[model samples]
Target chain A: MTDALQTDPRLLVLAQGDNIAVLKATIKAGEDILIAGNEVHVGSTLGLGHKLAVVAIQGGDDVVKYGFPIGFAVADIPLGAHVHVHNLASRYTTVEIME
Target chain B: MPEMMAWPRQDGRKGIRNVVLVAYLVECAHHVCKQIARPFDESDVQVIGFSGCFPSEYGQDMMTALCTHPNVGAVQLVSLGCENFKKSQLAESVRASGRPVNVVTIQEAGGTAAAVEAGRAWVAQTRAELQNLPMVAMQPSELVIGTICGGSDATSGITGNPAAGVAFDRLVSEGATCIFEETGELIGCEHVMAERAATDALRPAIVDTVAKAARYYADMGYGSFSNGNATGGLSTIEEKSLGAYAKSGQSQICGILRPAQRPATGGLYLLDVVPDGPPKHGFPNINDNAEIIELISCGAHAVIFVTGRGSVVGSAISPVLKVCANPETFTHMSGDMDVNAGRILDGGGQLHDVGTEIYEKLVALGAGARTASEALGHVEFVLTYKSQSPSNPACYPN
Candidate 1:
């Protein structure tokens, strides 16, 4: 990956205050990525279009994206960890994931 | 200053294309209607129909609106002769609209072969005269545009939806009529959306529309959220809604509209797509094409469709411009996409830059350009049973 792709907000983050950033490409476990001018280590392999926490989020904190709260974190999420159905939940409707 | 070359209608609305429409009044007549339009394929003789044999006011109204749609120059009504679809009344409405209308009863015409031959002959005769219909020039202010997103993902909100939003904003600024809809998917952004209502009367209506959608979904045991949405990294309906809501841009909500209802004077109107009262008709919309047909029924000349996971659908009457949001999806489906809003995610330009690209493209489409879906002949259409109360008078207070 090029340094420019890592630093571009278009490729990494959508808005300034969003706690989570979407992946434009897949990343392997233990790979390092940059977020808000800081280097963060990827904890798991996540595919393209998945999201990851850009900042440390405590349990029950609002997960922000597009400068609005999409939902809240269900557990204490460390920086660069995956923020998904297991770790995040909606405040309005139940997220039913079919097995 | 973009101008559209179009066919003028008696109702004072203008159509971007003058294509003949062959309509089936019931599912039983669908085959003959399809066969009738098949011979005129690729020349804009399109087919649309209602599948329900049982009588429905909603179904009748939708068929009437679609058959008399501005894009349609003439219509052929195919009926099975005993299906209670109100074929005569539908034909009268089309005739009243000052468009050529024909009715071919399969039972009366001696069978499928006879009916198809009769319908095809009328279509051929009608298609010949469409070229001579008086043409008119329409300004951007006279154009009605619509927006919807399907097969969406995380990249949708970040790139494609917002870019379409920007284009929506630009079009609204130029005095074009613009609409965005499906209140069922906008469950979480009610309060935020209400803040932009143009009138105080419209505020509560906005909130109530979303609340109705929430209640109906709760009763049905399913939200508009889907498994594909979940796999695409959308954790909840709220996340998907927040992204979906971005397609409206930042315009003040001018009014609320029901299916077959056009905006009185459009800035940006929210189409209340969820059914009123109960969840009797199952899901408010069966799929994305249903929503597209609703928009076309509301007088949109063309629609803006954004996607992240990727969709390749275009409606029967109006052109659907596909804006691909994910760079990878765009790479895989480049031939099906009209705008590469995904480039915004690849560090090509700002979201507004793509917004500008979408705006310019809509103008080109108005000036007689074919969208990717249009060029590929994707005239997919659907109109299912649905219920909507007439618009509240206060929702459109002057």
Candidate 2:
């Protein structure tokens, strides 16, 4: 890998102890980046501000961000996987996504 | 010390802008009021009103607060004569504030044409009289600022909202009264906020207010989470709340303010935008402008609006500084934005850098520099029916 590509940081961890990190910019599938001491390959294209798991989250586990649990995972979510409405559900209010 | 030359009001408040407010009593008189104010620039003559034909104690209080707002130099009330809003009583309240007040009823004035003519004549004269309003030296401690995050995306928490929080912290430390609202959006951060309360009694008040919002939204079968919020990558209400909560900064929240109620001292406060009872109103706020109007009614001289999805709405009586959170959205809607907090996320600046920029811009705004929305004539205003009782004294221990 080139020096510029290796040095660029793509994910932003808002606070310590946050299990998920936000994407600083859009990234295409197959891009490998180091997160939490692990180099994880991107499984799919993710847009800016979208969340990615810094650590593997099991089914029914809480998705933590800003050092607080934002929601619980509906299913098992692997590290570097996208965390969104599909696998996450609100702890307070239901996110009724229209099909 | 941050200070500016501001318009001094009889109520002992300072206003960043001296405005001639043309207020319509009901939806029936809206067109006439609009036509009356159409001839003048929005900066000089701005139209604001309540649309409900039925009487609402909440609506009445909001109108009274808005019409007597320090920013309003004079007011002209347009009434349809049949609506339940007591126009004469409103006129009396406006007069009591030591401002010139006029009322024109469409039924008594012979209809739309005559009413519009009378309203325009009054507004024209009021505009002339507003030119001689005294400008006094005002400090940051004398200012009341409000903040709201609309069209939020994930960028809001990390970039825009946190930057705004920095600005709020600075303003609060300077002894300026700073308010942050939209309790419906703060569904899951109640405990976090409670910990930041100034007094022990305020903890329950803060916790109870968020619970009220959670229950209200549950009954309505909706949280404040919109499709745009999800599309922008916010998955749930709790997730959005965590992000929105960052806008409050780390200051000790001194009090909780209900709509149309002013804070007695300069400090950090939380505004409960949701109604007191169950979901009587469709939503806590119909849109961002409603919350902005609520903040203005409580005496915000200017509002700091943090947006990730890029909201362009401004207020009639107060200035709205749009802090765009997403770098991509800022690139697309630069004309509508003031501060580019997105730069922090883009690796161009630190969070404190953007926060300081917002703080400086607000101080400049107080010195008569118009916000991007204000300069673009985005005078969007809204007020609807909602019920709220007086706040508990415990919430304001100071």
Candidate 3:
């Protein structure tokens, strides 16, 4: 395993064999992130410590964290797009968004 | 099957760590107890205590639970001579559990200087005995973990809290014990929480506990749901409660645990934080650290702390894994937080990914890896007297 791959600036994999990667720092819209040898543009301006999809996801897809589904995507999210209330909804109950 | 690890005590119950706990019998003896624990410095000798002048059955019960907590292998009881605390009963209960226990009264032992010296010697011996004990392999099923989110904001509900819930689900499914507490914060979601209870009897108990918290806080001239919560973007208590409830991870509520009470079996349990009666006690939990201390007394091996505004406090006995939900807060307080659930809010990661990371971190901690708080030596602990009758036989089948 390459040390560069493990400490990549764009994404951090906390556990081995996990499907998702956490952003180490924010990526502005149109910023490119290299994951799995592919570079994808940042769809929305993600704040520092925010999340972006490392892989393409379809509408109604359940977003997985800690290896379990926390909620579902409200819209189709392209690779490297921000994943928050704008694109996701809690599976248990509805939440209000201010703004 | 999930693997398990345990430190076998003289008693049959398995522990994750062999700890020597120094306990202050009353608020009066706290200084001396702290002095004794200070010398051991990272030797697993944690200081925990009861801060009551007048004797209460609840105080004695909590002391007994803490002294004999699974993580604790030995105990030193520090007393100030004229207190009404039943030090004998407290010592006996711990000794009966087959753990080493010592009681030293400052007045009888020739005051502060003499007591500190004697207490230090005792701590050295306890630590010596604890160090050589075999470290057994522990499993996820053997762990009793607790979750509490303090200083919450809107991001807490959306990100860190739900991420914790995802982790809780995985642990419970693996036969690990998990507890989620703070009935006051859970006021809005009691109905939803009750629906997940293992039995119909527990459903009403769940609702009643939140109602009790509401009344208790209301009598104190402020709602238990704080104004800071609103400043952090929470509109109503229900909104906060709904978010706080996510930490339970959709597991069936197994049983209700009183402060410092261990579950008879592994699964998800709700801790009832409200006092049994009116506002005799000033506040149910004075602060976040008090809540964390109570969970430790109930035998939690560690805790998952979710926050949006950012809480830096940790417990004395159990290691706290801080999960930051607000991306901005995570940026500012990155050193203090262990997991950045806020990434989910920024669209960098999904809930399940963070949840799995937290679960794996929990396992790693159980395997003896130090958490951010543990590595930073944030061993904060507090205990105070509050009254509560035993749970109804129907609620907790002994």
Candidate 4:
């Protein structure tokens, strides 16, 4: 929405030390985007509020956000890949929604 | 800081709303309670009931807390004459607080019809006394603030929640007691949350309660996390927890406050909503409002409710100030929300700006400004049976 935001991170980076960045707008696969001055290609189509791998994540490694481990990657997650339940897994079992 | 008109209580806690509470001791007495409150629908007189026929330690403690909640000016108890809901004890407590309390028993009052008549008359008399109670201007330090999230969406985590977190931080720094609850929902955030504990002793309680929540939900066959939460893009319980935990901002978590336990000091507190033992009666919270009631019982003067998908519910006594996160959802449910936290996503405003607005809105609401839900008379209430020992010593008031 401003020149500062565009040149800053290209997306919403919650913390400076965080690995994942939340998408401010939807992104399509193969689009080149500027992230904190680093040019990277979008690896997948992602929806808003979805997380994108701003850094390379190896299998069995913790995925950090909010400066803490929210979950771990089940497989290799490349830069610009959408991180979700498919590749990212919660260490705890997912629960049922009663209603 | 804005000045607030406070209704002083004998215990020195004070209140923002001079609400007349009509409480039903059992399911059977619910009808009489409803009938009495219906006539006064335009008034601040509200109805809350304990729906269990059997006795429970948690239920008893909850009832006592509700009767003595800071928002209450007077209490009216309706009993079926045969339940263990503790009408006498509640009345005795309110009466001791120097507030007018009227108890009507259905069996002695000649059934529902007669009890309703007596209850209505009692409400009329109590309402006058409630209005006549003296009001004084107070500062922010005298306030106890509570926050909760319902029905999250993607925008909620990134906008509404973070905004509320900012407000929590500001409120705590200003010397107000701030509380955030739902330990069951914070399963994955145990480590991160533990890092903010104010002391070494408090860290274990925070970790253990979250573990307790995880075990209880595991046995219940489902955690508090829902499909609605998933559609919001949260992949796991921990992810949702990080969002929920954000409402605490960066304040040091003083200690764990169980249901109906008030914080002893002015600081941020985490309410452990999970029942102490294995799950009993039903889910720990029947819905979001049940959890809201628990916060009220602990003496919250007002509640900051953040909703991303849009929730219209409000509390009976303590007004619920809603902060909506989704711009589209806010557009549709603008009438229900008090603050547009979605401005952050739209880039119209930042988190601190919205948080500052929430803090100011809280002060205005304390000055007798009605919230959207309160103006619409959306008084949603629920209380269920559960067993638990009293809160651990760390949680008691200073």
Backbone Cα, N, C clashes tallied per candidate: 0, 0, 31, 2
Candidate 4's residue-wise lDDT over A1-99, tens digit each? 342444324367676567788876677887888654566777777777888877789999988877777789999988767788888888876444444
For residues B1-398, what per-residue lDDT tens digits would candidate 1 score against the true structure? 36678899999888998878889988999999999998776537998999998888889888888888888899999999999899999999999999999999999999999999999999898888887887888777788999999887768877899899999998899888899997888999898899999989899999999999889988999757889777777787778888889899988989998888877785999999887888888888899999999999998989999988899999898899999998889999998999999887676888889999898888787687899998998999898888756778888746
How does chain B score by TM in each prediction?
A: 0.96, 0.96, 0.94, 0.96
Which ten contiguous residues of candidate 1 chain B have the minimum total lDDT? Answer: B388-397
Superior by lDDT: candidate 2 or candidate 3: 2
lDDT of 2 by residue, B77-167 (tens): 9999999998888899999989999999999999999999999998898888889876988887788999999887778888999899999
TM-score computed on alpha carbons, candidate 3: 0.79
User: Which residue pairs collide in model 4, if any?
Assistant: B264-B397, B264-B398
Give the TM-score (vs. native) of candidate 1: 0.90
User: lDDT of each structure?
Assistant: 0.86, 0.87, 0.77, 0.83
Predicted model with the maximum TM-score: 4
> TM-score for each prediction?
0.90, 0.90, 0.79, 0.93
1 versus 4: better lDDT goes to = 1
Q: Give the residue spans of candidate 1 off by over 4 A.
A: A1-11, A16-20, A50-62, A72-89, A93-99, B1-3, B224-231
DockQ per candidate, 2 decimals: 0.52, 0.60, 0.05, 0.50
Which residue runs does candidate 3 get wrong by more than 4 Å? A1-99, B1-5, B224-233
Q: Write the per-residue lDDT of candidate 4 for residues B135-244, one digit (tens) a residue.
A: 98878888898999997788877888888999989889999999898887788888788888888777788889889888888898985567766655677788888888
Docking class of 4: medium
Q: Per-residue alpha-carbon lDDT of model 2 for A2-93, expressed as tens digits?
A: 42243337788777788888888888898887775677788888877789997899999999987788989999999878999999997776
